[model samples]
Target: WRRGTNSIAVLGAPQVILYKFGHPSDAWWGVLPYWAGLLILSAPVGLTVYYFLNDHTPPKSTPLAAFLLSLAFISSCVWTDLIASELVSGLEFLGVSLGVSRSIIGLTILAWGNSIGDFVADTALARAGNPRMGAAGGFGGPLF
Candidate 1:
């Protein structure tokens, strides 16, 4: 049973990855990781640049220090993917056991739970410093 389940998970990964890479699904559930990674990787870079270029009162700390501080800002963005995968896996298990529909599990349980990290990371980054940089959409564009 375990082996079969593992095989299914391994095979399913490709479909998920391909779908995430722009398969044009209006309900693209797989793109969350890509979006999260963008936020995670960009926060440090953006904060470093902001510290250097901004004429306004920059962070009192050094560039490296500011960048490090923003590391959490970045990591928080992608942290959801790891967490969400686990959460969704568990939810799916329970849903399957209970004979719940996949569509409901995918849309409500997985989507809402995974999206929580995005919401928190976005809010945290914005509240931490520049609100503009915190936007996932804004940061993802340049990072990619």
Candidate 2:
């Protein structure tokens, strides 16, 4: 049984790589590794954000404060989307220059990068033994 599984894995590996990276002549195999390194480098930045947001309960807010907070949230969302677009565009340009298709970039790089947070959260929930919650999160978290 183990040998059969290993044989299946060996047979499947090349197809998976082909689908992900395309023809060797046209593919940029370094993009995913570069992306992974970026992810690792950004971990500290994410931790810093969590540190800032974790423990502070907002004080009772006046109506003006509430309005300002809402405005700030909206502005931050806009800024985040703007920055994401620029980064994605730059990545897409790099992929095109390397002879990769836009669809491949969108499917692999963009999808994986954007979904990493949901993936991590779901994995953590599963590891914590609340697999139903993790399954639900896996199914539902991407809707937003």
lDDT of each: 0.56, 0.61
lDDT of 1: 0.56
Error of 1 at 127 (Å): 1.3
lDDT of 2 by residue, 1-144 (tens): 233332333333334334344443342464554334434544454344334332344324656336435544654565576678789999999999999999999999999998999999999999999999999999999886
What digit string (tens of lDDT, one per residue) describes model 1 on residues 17-102? 44445442333366555435544545555444444444443345786445444543544444556566677789889999999998
Name the regions of candidate 1 deviating beyond 4 angstroms: 1-89, 136-144
